[model samples]
Target: MQIVIVLSLLFIAIILFATEKISVDIVTLIMLIVLCTTRIITPEEAFAGFSSDFIVILASIFVLTAALEETGILEFMIARLVKIASRGANILLFLVMLISGTISAFMNNTTVTAMFVSPLMGVSRKLKFSASKILMPLAFASILGGTCTLIGTSTNVAVSGYIDKAGLAPVGMFEISGIGLIIFVVGMLYMMTIGRRLLPNHQDSALTEEYKMQKYITEVLVLPNSPLVNQLVYASDLSKKKFKMLNIIRGKEKFLPDYRTRIQANDILLVEGEIDDLITIRETKGIEIMADVVLEDALQSPDIRLAEILITAHSNLIRHTIREIDFQRRYGLTVLAVSRQGETLRTQISDVKLKLGDLLLVQGAQERLNYLRSNQHLAVLEEFSQVLFRKRKGIITISAFVLAIILGSFSVLPLSISFLGAAVISILTGCISTDRAYEAIDWRLLILIGGMTAFGAAMDKSGAAQFLANGIVDWLAPFGKISVLAGFIFLTVFLTQPMSNAAAALVIVPVALQTAAALDSNPRTFAIAVMLAASVSLVTPFEPSCILVYGPGKYRFSDFLKVGSGLTLILILIIIFMVPVFWPL
Candidate 1:
């Protein structure tokens, strides 16, 4: 009955995770509550995961990664790499994949992809290649690289911690290096050969390409007999249409119009609307359309510039309509259009609720845009040139990180303490602020990891893990132990598509351990296999790193299937052959 109840809860949780109706962290918390309320696990056991050493290590890594980014070291290093990789397209792709993979082995792959997006765009322009050709490969390389180290991904740390609790030897830091390096090579070669051809060439449809607001904007002269003459701007017929009154030009003077501002005869109105609407207004509303209008003519000043800004997940503007936020009044910028999910939204944009991953084309003064850097709301994608570098602080923080790694490797300090000390040094040296350190840690991911770890304990307590493992072993016992190991790897890889890598690994680790014990095989080998498998087999854009590049790459869902499927299959075979060889399952 306990096994049945636990299995039922696990089934429901898996459905919720895949459906994404509720957040993953919430689902995990629910599972913990159910387990505790059912007396499957005590309250102490349910909450124990939050105090685990792995959680501390994971949080410290987040702070350390943020400090490295803040110091401009990553930008400085990537810029130098781009210069050297400027030889040709293929070489550039290869070098970028290698660099991105190496960095992702240390930092989060999502962060790595975000850092490289603008640089790779610069590379695309310089080499006359398309971003679509490179971005998918860049995201995939980062995923592959996460397989290289225990600290490389949350999945590795979670699985290692689980094994340690099971009384098996913990995973070494560089234990996966041998297989991981080979898998990276295989992925790189695949992208260079077949994956390159499968990728789209989106050079012509760059985000800036669609930012041509000149054609969409028009100047109209209010005729002497116009009904809107001497009418309040808010009460005018122009408000009924989709046209937005940007500014009013009367003779030599210009003014930005508001609701109370009145229009007069012969007053030139700079209106932003569709071309068809502008033509219709001229024919029906006693307005004269000006020919040969330029973007400069609509705005009075030459100081204002147009650029693309991405709404990050941390942005305050999310869930609010553009007009509700009074975006023009608050930021002193005019939004031209919004790009999201590979579609350019030009009409009804004012009513569209902003979401993360939306790209907004905005025209504003350089000073106002400069203020955006400190806003922490929107990222100005155009201005990648201005990088902040604190050389002394960067050197100190980097040295601290290396020392932490050394102490951890030599067993002089626990991995968590070493990294936590490094993070403290980074903050003390002013490499990153306390607030920035807090912002850098993914609280949702931490919650999910913590809550799910308790679920692992619940499964163990309820005998659900043993029951499932016995079933799997009974079914696969006809095959060799190696075949059973391969089955677990495949199961983990498939599960990651529906859940996070760490969640998938944690869910599978307990079962894999039970199965290994039943078969008299090394449980640590199965644990490590589950961890690495979770990192690979990323055959969809559901992964955060892949989602970051999806829009920039201008890729279809099929593109990942075409390219990532082959790579995932290759890596599976590699893991199946490599795992037993290393741990002798």
Candidate 2:
């Protein structure tokens, strides 16, 4: 009855996780409560998972990675890497995947992938290659790279801790490097050889080619007796059709037009959009395109173009509005637009206010741009060509991180202590500010992992794990331990397609352990197999890293399925063959 209840709760969690109707962390917490309340598991056992050393280690690693990011170290490394690659689609793809995978082995894969998204798109456009060809491979490489070390991903750490509790020694950092290396090589080779062929070429419709609004912007005259005279700009297609009024010049003064402002006679309107759209507005709305004056005529003498700037936590612009800071006079930049997550900006940027991590689209002279970036606060993303260097702090930050990994792997210190020490050292060395480090840690992921760990513990304590394992053991009795291990690996890989990789691993690990016990086999083997399988979730585009690159790559859902399914099949075979070799069942 406990097994049935646990299984039912597990099924419900999976459904909720996939549907995303509520947060995954909330769902896991609810599962824990249900198990404890129904006497399936004691409260003490249910809450024990939170105190697992694994969660501590995972949290420490997050802080360490955050420190590296705050120091601008990863950005510097990636910039140098992208610049060195030879100018060709195939070569660029190979270099990016290799570098991304290597970095992901140490850093958070999602953050590493996010750091490269914009730069990769810019590089693809400049080189005349399909962004789609490179992005999927990059995402896939990060996934494969997470297998290289125990600290490469949370799943590996969780599995190792669970195995340690089951009376086996925890796996070393490089212990699984052999299989991981093999998988990485195989995956990269497939991408360069076969995967490249499957990716759709979308060079023509690329963002750089299609979204260049510089040529479309022109000043237009709103003449007296025109049909558009005294009409609100919002009432016309200007608002509905996405036409932007850059500025309005009247007599000796010029103003950036507001959406609600009404058009007046002889008003010189600086408008930007496609030529066809501008022509349609001119003809139908009785506005005349100003052919004589350039864009600088209505604004300051210096010309400006829209640029998207990512507001770092350290940025001076945080919480301050354009009016409050006198942004134009103080920073010599005008915030024309801002976008946060998926929302678009409709109000005047200055009046809309600012927040940490907001992506702002600003207009300013190209020369003073670096001033805006270097304030140690804002991360200007428009200039992907320039390499960011933390030359002074790089050696120190890298040394601290390496020392932590070395100490943890050698058992000189627990992973939690090693990483925590490294994070402290980083802050002490001034490589990263304390506040920035705090902000960089992914609290959402930590919460999710913590909650799910508690749920996994409950399942184990309730005899639910043993019951489920007995069923699997009976089902696979005709087959050998190898078949049973392969079954667990395949189950994890399949579940990861629709759900998160960490959640999938958590759900499978207990059952896999139970099955091993039922067969009188080593649970460590099953644990390791499940961990590797969970990390190689390439069969779908739902992963955060994959989604970040999806639209930029112009890839369809079918594209990921077509290429990633093949990769997933190859990885499954590799795991089956390698698991017994390294960790005999």
Error of 1 at 429 (Å): 1.1
Error of 2 at 323 (Å): 18
**lDDT per model vs. reference:** 0.82, 0.74
Q: TM-score, each model?
A: 0.87, 0.79
> Backbone collision count in every prediction?
0, 2
Instruction: Please tell me which predicted candidate would have the highest lDDT against the true structure.
Output: 1
Using TM-score as the measure, which candidate wins?
1
Segments in model 1 whose C-alpha atoms lie over 4 Å from true places: 206-304, 311-331, 345-356, 370-379
Pairs of residues clashing in candidate 2: 314-377, 315-377
